[model samples]
Target: MLVSIRVAAEELGVRPETLRRWESQGKIEAPERTPGGKRRYDLAKLRHLAPHKAPSERVTILYARVSTNGQRDDLVRQRALLETFSSANGWPYEVIEDVGSGLNYHKRGLKQLIAQICSGRVGRLVLSHKDRLLRFGSELVFSLCEHFGVEVVIINASENSTFEEDLASDVIEIVTVFSARLYGSRSHKNKQVMDRLREVAKEVSP
Candidate 1:
């Protein structure tokens, strides 16, 4: 996909002039020019900024997550599928699994993933589905990955939710977060609230 310099800079959390400077400094690939002489960047190439570390030292990561302990079987299956995919591609990969709510950003697995990415030890990230990373704000992680020149691969990109489904998800996420905050995560009251909300969510969903 092609995007204007402003869009690319915004995604990277950098100023537009920084992109122009990087282009001039050979830090990034030169962008395509429009008929009116405006610059357009290839989104894919823009993601692969020059890495700070040697390629051989970086590892590909296969990450999976499930909302609760009840989904252990699903998590295992996700791990196995990711391993098979990486093996087929002959990539040296490691698997990171999390049993937590997607709305929670403080997951240990997620923290470790961010640390590795910041340390320049991640060459790529592979996911079975996009939301497997987070219920929301997955793009922030992707932006960090892009800033560090880590390639992102999503095996199932067609699993997008309809508007109604998304609304259901958002409702559930809000309930889950606020219930935990109001009643404490392990409190019986929170459990009761979640149980009722889940039913309501199902009713509203397709």
Candidate 2:
């Protein structure tokens, strides 16, 4: 069914003049004309037009990550590169950074970005490299992007030392967690000794 220009514009949260202007600019198809030559918008067409955000209007996400705190400088560099890349593409974007293992899914920033992607607010995802997004399951995210009509751009698709670094970091993290657990368990009988042992484990963690 069709609605009058005024009603359609109100429902779409735009002024009637704005809709008319967009129609004249060919940004959207013209609404159907009434017998009296007044414009009326089809509900289906109006809804479809609502999501057609222009490149500048769309939300772009620049995601960057490093495997450890020792690589904070690398995180800064990655954010800078993402900012430059997004600027060159002529779109404003939010930079999301994570300082944790790529193989881990519990990063706060990563979860927030994924929520935005699934919510349909994200129009594009820009990454310096694919592995920068994840170590193994990055394709699952890319598939989600494809399903949501979000474009994925990789500035440097070439594999670098990042993959190996993440592997090493993951190994260290796994070992540390197990060592901590083992130490605590074996020393449960001696509370004072267990506390000191955990402290030493923390000092040795890299």
Candidate 3:
């Protein structure tokens, strides 16, 4: 699908002006111009800016995340499906697995995959669904992929509904933030209790 500069900017979390500047600087290639001189970005161009690499001689990377231990079998199935997809397409593939909450991509395997993408080791990233790869906001991840000239393929039906994904991400962010706060408060209380016990022991000794 073709998108206007404004829509592309919104999807990419960048100012339209910045995209223009990047085009001018040759950091990013300029999109095709319409008869009316409006810029139009194709899926190819947008994927070129993905956090992963464009399909080249390099192998594609498949990232699979299972939210819990019980989903380990699901993770394997995902990997198998990706391998089959790659084989059917005649593409080389590498698989990365993370057994953690999809709420974040900071897991060790995911981090390694990102490192490879940033280093230009992988040509493309394939995920079963946006939510499978992004329980958090995909904007940052997409931006990173784009900056590195990577390509991404979401194998699900919803393609790329940035608005819906953003809403879901906001909810996940709130939960994560609150969970962290609660953990911090509990830690603080535990520290205080330990401190009081130390003081009591010292007073009794004196």
Candidate 4:
């Protein structure tokens, strides 16, 4: 059966505000309201909506990424930290490593992690930091986790900030715009050089 908002909050071990924020962000579906406008949540839905419990039998998945080739060892460090963290917490976990620019989320290791989450094989996703897992933004990752009912734990931040506050779409949009402009300028320069080459070729041919 569904529970009330207050009960859900208690069960989830999060503030009502957090739940409200998740709803606002579309990270999770909004709860159904009663005649009096009180929110109601089903037990199954509550389990799905709630964050992964700190101590649970479910397996936790760790994702670590390094931006450059020099940072390959950094991936190892991240894996170590995740292992230590999980061991210290007595949580059974596995490590998945990806070495690449955080600018793209389509890395092979990331794809495997997402697939596992989508398949409900993972209960929680642990990351070293927002930038490590999401230099692009959190929305895409957040939405993916929310859709699959997986909990996310960013180990770097003790408190949330603007990076944590804004929607993922906004962050990704900014990155996309910057990338487009950079490529567009380069394309323009290349086109100009090609045009000059064509003119020189025509004059020489005559």
Give me the candidate number with maximum lDDT: 1
Candidate 1 residue lDDT tens string, 107-139: 999999999989988888999999999989998
Q: What's the ranking of the predictions by lDDT, best on top?
A: 1, 2, 3, 4
Writing each residue's lDDT as its tens digit, candidate 3 over 1-206 gives 88998777655544466579888999777788999999998756665555322546766888888766777889899888888887888878888888766666578987898789788766677888777776766667766766765666667736665665456544544444445545677787755655555455444431
Per-residue lDDT of 86-188 in model 4, one digit per residue for the tens? 7787778888888765667678988898788777777778887766775666667767776555667777766555543444433443444354455677787
The TM-score that candidate 3 achieves is 0.56
Q: What is the C-alpha lDDT of each candidate?
A: 0.83, 0.74, 0.69, 0.68
Better of 3 and 4 by TM-score: 4
The root-mean-square deviation over C-alpha atoms between each candidate and the true structure, in angstroms, is 6.4, 14.4, 11.7, 11.6
Q: Lowest summed-lDDT stretch of 10 residues in model 4?
A: 164-173
Off by over 4 Å in 1: 1-57, 180-194
The TM-score values for the models, in the order shown, are 0.70, 0.56, 0.56, 0.57
Instruction: Give stretches of model 2 more than 4 Å off.
Output: 1-56, 159-206
The list of candidate 3 runs beyond 4 A from truth reads: 1-55, 157-206
Q: What number of clashing residue pairs does each candidate have, in the order they appear?
A: 0, 0, 8, 1
Using lDDT as the yardstick, the better of models 2 and 4 is 2
Q: Name the best candidate (by TM-score).
A: 1
Model 1 scores a C-alpha lDDT of: 0.83
Give the per-residue lDDT digits (tens) of candidate 2, residues 74-177: 99999999999889878789888898776678899989989998888888899998888876689888767755656677888655555456555445555544
Instruction: Give candidate 4's total backbone clashes.
Output: 1
